[model samples]
Target: MEITIWDEYYELLPRKELEKIQLNRLKRTLIRAYHNLPYYRHKLEAEGIDIHRFKTMQDLKHLPFTCKEDLRRAYPFGAIAEPLRNIVRIHSSSGSTGSATVVGYTAGDIEIWAELMARTLTGSGASEEDIVQVAFGYGLFTGGLGAHYGAERIGATVVPMSTGNTARQVQILQDFNISVLCCTPSYALYLAEVAQEQKVDWSKTRFRIGIFGAEPWSEEMRADLEQKLPIQAFDIYGLSEIIGPGVGFECQARAGLHVSEDHFIPEIINPDTGEVLPPGETGELVITTITKEGTPVIRYRTGDVSSLIPEPCACGRTLTRIKRIKARTDDMLIIRGVNVYPSQIESALLSFKELEPHYQIVITKENFMDRVDIKVEVAPEFFSDEVKTLEKLKQSIEEKLRAELNIHCHLRLMEPKSIERTSGKSNRVVDLRKKEGLT
Candidate 1:
């Protein structure tokens, strides 16, 4: 397999030299965090740590862990290290849980973000000649602008579709002869379905590469997407707290996502104990921004569960790669004494050829006990009027869910297009337990 290299200087930087650069950046970031941010300053003082004497990467473990709550407590601008005038752009989290956490970027920070994005696009098999259409929503969300800047930086013709208007998105994909598509994984699959319904011929256009992220999807989902869209689908990972969609990207090998070690440091730690686990041990992902100047974070707990692959990738990039996220620590659901993740349910549902990847997990309290019910939509052809056939299908799905989720769950089969679809991130889980007066 042929792989595209974006920046030979940094992407292929020597390990020793890279570490030296990281240490320098880490020291500078800590200095700024200690002197500029009150929250970080207080935390460091309470720990009896001298920010000026902060030494090497090994010292990362000694620093305090920053969580989403820290950012929330700091609110919009307290986390920022640079002056307000230096900030050129800001992107914020959706704050579905609470107050939105804001992330700022200086002029230089934006350039670095664009560079990382360019690397992401090229690493996913895109080129300067390819026409890239970004379907992620723009504005306070980072997905749209992050992808837009990166594609432009790579000299690709960017459509800047910026989510919604599914009909128009299809029209642009066909009319513009777009070779690369960027959006959430669920949106990609949804587009494939809509395009087929509109009789858009794939062979006529140059649509072959898909860059998907902003949600956790299974390998089964990837295979289903590849078969449905006839494209090489690659997973890109990032968050607003980090640098949006360019923090890590998969190469042609598709084994793991290579992190941009020159700018960010990745660590896996036990969610409960906070002990940094060795490579290949699954735990919550923690990150520290080494080069970020606007709003640098130290040991920011991402809450994503995955392991590090210390082994060199076949693509020849020496940067360490992280296994695709299995499930976020916070996304894990406890039901009937068993821990379950939505991706586990998704993997089981997508395994069946007769079912679509569209499903919803509904959690509600029943008689003081937690219950999980999955409502899945079957392929249009698989939906039948026969009661026996439908029941058999439901039984098969329930059995598979039991094997994968390790707990029996109530399963219901629905007709095609019965579940709500979105061009943005798909809301797969509907937890009604809270509304039922259970905390």
Candidate 2:
């Protein structure tokens, strides 16, 4: 129950103790799941797996990998291990993919999550002496509650400032003298932009650190966030299935995220073959939470693409660090920052009657920027006019995308059949940013 907060805390422990302790946790989790979770028991039986055989981390490779579909197939409550009475809280996933994924937690599960977050805050120099402000949304969304509990556990003064109303958020920053901020990277940047217009003295504010996550952002974007905001920024990573943001966090040294391996075992593997990859090799991340009580999953394929490093970091933590996500493997274009999937775009575009579902997304390079071309094959009636329908369609798409993604995107229209068809997963974005950068 009293796990140390950082990898460095246990790095010096003899190799035998580390393995012995981890095995004990693993065995207990397996024994508990086999008895309480029918899905897990059935899965183990179907796969003919004996947890006793998986005595070491190396044995993880032999277990069947889990995926999001596994959750969908066991929807609502099948995956939950603990009974309804013990589950104290639940949160909905942002779900860019489809219907939101729901994550549940028992009181003990919440306690452990708070412990990791408290450890993370301490690593970043937050303490009872600091005031923590949370700007993420509350209710079903996980980010707000996650930060609130972490801040509370750390004994910091907590300000639960859920999203929307920029002026109010700014007022809290000035009045409360918030020393730490926990919110999405975009929202932090947005707040800074408002402060600039309002002539807010950002430097005078007490904020010393910002923990941003819940959305993918670029290093360039991260730099922008730090420069504009009043504090140094650290990346926080989590998912609904893994008990939210405390799963891994960045320290001031900023090498990579320190994974909470005591609770969730992190691994990287080839997206296609599920072959376990070595540290520093970029691949999809899969996590199996050993500590969750209400709904526990083993070898859950997170669908997030990242790499891992096992070496002790300069920050003196021996915990594993996961690289920034390259992209989500299952849902969409897993490029750098953009998470847009063509199917979701199609659904949006088709909502307008004038636009045809038959459109092509041509991702290309131009002038050191990503040139994305959305070619919507116009209906025969609209094509009859000599006036270029492309321009109007471009405007419509630009407006819709701006409203949806909060970023400006260029649009293009092609006659039907312009997009090259393929038998497998089709290319949605042809990134020319790489070539542009090279030249």
Candidate 3:
């Protein structure tokens, strides 16, 4: 397949030239944050860090790290570098954990975002001839609008079907002759299930490419999705804190996601000590947005865990690539001294042919000990089998999970479509220990 690069000039720039551009933008962003944002200004001044003296890219480490907590403390407008008058748009987190972290964007920032997202779509094999359907949630969430602007910028026909109403979405998929679908990976699976239930022929639709993000997924899930849906699934990585879903994307090579280094710098650091790790070492991802005019974050610690791939990609883009995110620092679950991620369990479950793609991890405290119970849906044919056979399959799944996770866990086999589905990010883990007032 021929690779499509939206901005060949920057995307294909030599490493030395790209670094020069990154250095300049990095300096400009540091100055903007230091002078305009009070939180950043105070942090810099207290640390005795002089933004003007930022002569080299290495000086970035001397600066303080920006965490989600800092953004929350900044609240509605503290972190915004540009004045409110210049800020033309606002997007925020769900604040389900604490206070919502609000992000602002100037017109220039939006333009940069659109350009990056256009690059994202093009890298994922989208073109102007494709009819794109965006199902990411709109409004406060950035996924929907961010993708919308990018599809339009690339001159692709876009259907802004902002999440929910699965039936309507399936109908549009069948009627609109949509060529590209954009949404969370889990939701894509749900859509495929619904379409199958409705007896819609996947080969009849024009859907060919699926750009999935807003949540971490596994390659196993990708294979499952491809098997069920007639589309090439591509992973797009981004967070609202770092300009939504266009930070990076996978090329046709599918080796790793190419970070748009001209606009944002990517780094992998030890999550515990904050030490920048060497290439190929997995750690938390840190991003610095250089061209952002509004909420410019310096060394922002994105909790997502991934590694930097230093090798050149077959797609010929020189931008740095980060491995697809499979786990997050915040999402790690410690059960009986064993560290487990939902993706690990998902991979293990998907390896079995008799199981469906839907599953949930429920963590609770039993007798002051952490107990993990996984509930997964079985294929209809298997679900209707004799009890003895079902028990044997359940034991086999438990053993598979134990071998994969390195910890024993109880497995509950559920009937087909027993687990509830979501139109947005899937709720795969439910930790009842917190609700039970257990530490």
Candidate 4:
């Protein structure tokens, strides 16, 4: 239960002092964005935002809000604040949802990112002595390099095992004696399954801590991981648009992910009205990059739903903590007038001992009504159960789903390993309404 904090001076700064730093950085970011980036300038002018008159943090409400669409519109380089000559590195989104959001970083920005990630690793109980293995993908995706730099910054022995090759990942876990692992939560579960298949002894492995993010997971998922693997799983939160994976991290307290307030300012706003909600109120997450020089966003709407915890953490960091992100506004599924989130389904499925964590939510429109069909993989032991037993289990699962989601769903029990697995973010939801010309 050792509490390790990187850059204690900044991480444990008093609330009043942190606000002063945030205000100063906010002003600098606004001035640079308004002057260098035409996109911000136009938005600021249209909203009649006066950067100089911003006396308190409350004035941030007057600034224009940025969204993914805006970043997509900016594309390649429209959002970058610094000159091309000064930009040192670039990372981008997968463009799987839309046009990719490209984020640039200056040498200073990279240093800041490394520092924030160092704090993240330290907060997650990773120390310089730990041999860290980063399983997130490299290149355009930010997770791999963001973690690589952070582990290096903290003086840890880093093994850059960038995604895929499940067998090799397990081999390295034992061969390299990796003490810390970083990857998506689903992928971690997949690795554990693979390890079991290989008959690898978890007790012999040095793996102790796992830092997972880049997709939404639930507490039930965390419990499953801890039960399956020999590690204490911690959640980390960040997006490529907001300095990759260093925006926030979980401390030893495991209460909530602490926002790196000195570097980025976070707010919760009503997704529909764009009105900022008070702390402890659930809403869309909005972030403003105060220290980012290459692409400083002004109240950028993250599309993530979470609330802020203003109370100080037992870890002793003054940074505000955000409830683990379980759903995004855009990811919420409206099925037959009921709102359903994939995580909700995952939670329900994991609650059943007969069900594996791997599942998919297939949404389609049937006769002008939305239908949710969940394909869940049964645990290996239950896969061979009698048809009657399987049917009874399926019925029980459907009843649980009905109770939890308040919506009827067709649950299909599949043999173990039937559902496809990925080394990166697992695709949990398949929405075919638009493809079926029903949207």
Candidate 5:
């Protein structure tokens, strides 16, 4: 019951048969969307879309894409194809960038999400007897519920301890002898620190596989976490817009994440133009949810930079996979186990017009320490080209970075062009830890 083989049964099926199944599902979703949802029907009608005539997947490209803006404009429950009473649960984003994208799931949709998650768990060797501790927050957000249901589906004993209760989370893992753990990779590192602080015997614990997401992580960071916790850490990818983390997960091979393409279609396309790129070429990851019953998105541009691998996986799943994400196009920065965005810094920096937007962040290493330094060019007219004025500005910027980024930043105020500015995007953080020979 653990590892149900999907590829053996369906992988060798004719490509056209798989296409037919996908087409049938797409037709059902399209009909549900066109008849029940006002936003999609009006938009499709405006575009003169003959929904009936579009029979193939390529034909789907003719329809307009659904962006986060569309969800924001509609707000909560506007995109739902089913009645409110029929929805078993809701999931949402913070809308910090714009309006929050609200998602509803039918009872069946919840079951489907769980089934995919179970596949994630067991495919990674998580067993029914394993005590699974879910460390994500439970709410309208997708992270907690998605993993909770998946762990339960695999018959693993699930502990529903939500995020931010690090002490409590650590206590439960120590008390119950939990095996499989899930959380953002950053939080996992934080929890490991607590285990060290509390003098917990990590070796005596049953902890095994770690499913981590909600932030970008590096292989170096993974090694760091594994060294502390001494367990296999995995990268699970998902977005609230196109289902949560169950879309794909890492198998033992660690080569690439095997996506549930049979349920969700994965494609690498040009971010700006939406042109489909070749398999090996790097581009944005776009997902089309073919099997989702609620709020199915079509070619939703994920804005995540990565490459696609359509070849058969060694894990016995013929599903297409993607390489590790390089970075997000948005102004996001991860510093010392925290998610910091430029807007968070911009809001802090804009408190005074004395500072200019023409600033560069220098993330350097010195004396075996990870340091974040912000080198900025203040307005020339506001401050004379003097080191004293620069020092004053430096103090101001450091306070703001601490307040906004939640991490202390060494602020260096320089004369205009002290740090070169390009007409294009400038480097925000320069990580010099490796060049200095510090891991």
Candidate 6:
């Protein structure tokens, strides 16, 4: 029941004061984009938006929504508002397409990023006395460096164990007696398996806190990780386009992620119609970087599916909270004329105690129609020797899928440790329909 509030001045600011601060910073951000970035200027002009007339936060809706395509159109530095000389670092998405979405950070921007990350880590019960092991990948991917800098900022001893090297990662965790772990949830679970294989008892170690993000995960997975590792697992959220991995994070309260409203403004909108939905309504989460200097975005569509909770957090933070991301708009899968998300499938699978959290959803084209299949591994104790028992388990899984997904899907029961595991974000969906040009 311990609660730690980092940056009490900002984190505990009154709602009215926080909004006023957001408004002021937002004005400066808009002016910077309108005056420096031609893309924003042109878009504003085309929409007949008078930047000067933008007085209230409500006026932000009048501005056009910035999407990933717009970032792609702008390419490397086109969206940047600062001079190239002021830019200190650059990061781009690992998009498997043509142009990558590039983001720039000035020296000040980097400092702010580190500070926000510090808040994220500290809020998750990390402290200066703790040893943090960052397993996120470095380079163009922002997770590694973002968490790295934040750990450093908090004056914690950070083990810069990037990604991969599962054996080595387990060795560090054991030898260093790491107290804090920051990485994707899937990787955390994978590490749990690796640690077990290496005869490393996480409960005996100093491990106490886990900051997991960079991919969407379920509360079921969180419970699994916490129980498996005997640690408190928290969701830390951020995107490269929005100052990396410190845009917001879940406090010890664990109700929702408290956004750094002083820096970024969050809104939930209907993904299909672009209409701003009321608070508590599930929709696509949109954000505006109100304090970014290098590449400030206006109403940038995050494509992350979440809802805004207008009520104050029990942790006493006035910052707005957004429910954990359910699914991304781009991550949705259409199977048999039904829109499905991998989270839905994960939720259904996790409900079964006999099934392991490791599962995959596949959508392929069959005879001019879409076919849905789910492959889930059985827990070690739940594995059966009898064919009848296996078939019964499969039938039970299929029945659950049918009840949850409302459509028939092929169920492939896998043996323990049969499914491929990734050191980074887990690829849960395989849509062969897109490959067949049938989407």
Q: What is the C-alpha lDDT profile of model 1 across 290-323, one tens digit per residue?
A: 8898889999999999999999999989889999
* Model 5: worst 10 consecutive residues (lDDT sum): 420-429
Error in Å for residue 213 of model 1: 0.4
What TM-score does prediction 1 earn? 0.98
Which regions of candidate 1 are displaced past 4 Å? none
Which residue pairs show collisions in model 3? Answer: none
Taken over the whole model, the C-alpha lDDT of each candidate is 0.91, 0.73, 0.92, 0.92, 0.74, 0.89
Pairs of residues clashing in candidate 4: none
TM-score for candidate 2, residues paired by index: 0.75
List, residue by residue over 23-93, the lDDT tens digit for candidate 6.
99999998888899888788899989899999998998888988888889898789888889999999988
For candidate 5, write residues 1-439 as lDDT tens digits.
Answer: 1344423554344556777787888887778778877887888989999788877788876776677777777787897778888887888886655779898888888888888888777767787889998987788778888999999887889999877767888899978989889887767866886687799888888888898876655665576678779688888888888888788777767667777766887778787787788898888888878788777777777877778877776766666788866466564566676776554564466455676544556666556456777766676568857778767777877887797677997776767646653211234456565466643
User: Which of 3 and 6 is ahead in TM-score?
Assistant: 3
Candidate 2 lDDT over 202-296, as tens digits, reads: 76789888888876555655665666776878788888888887888876677788886767789899988999998899888999888788878
The digit string of per-residue lDDT tens for model 3 on 335-413 reads: 8888888899999999988899899999999898998999999888656448888888889999998898899899998
Candidate 4 lDDT (Cα, whole model)?
Answer: 0.92
Lowest-lDDT window of 10 residues in candidate 4?
380-389
TM-score for all models, in order of appearance: 0.98, 0.75, 0.98, 0.99, 0.74, 0.98
**Which of the predicted structures, 5 or 6, would earn the higher lDDT when compared with the native?**
6
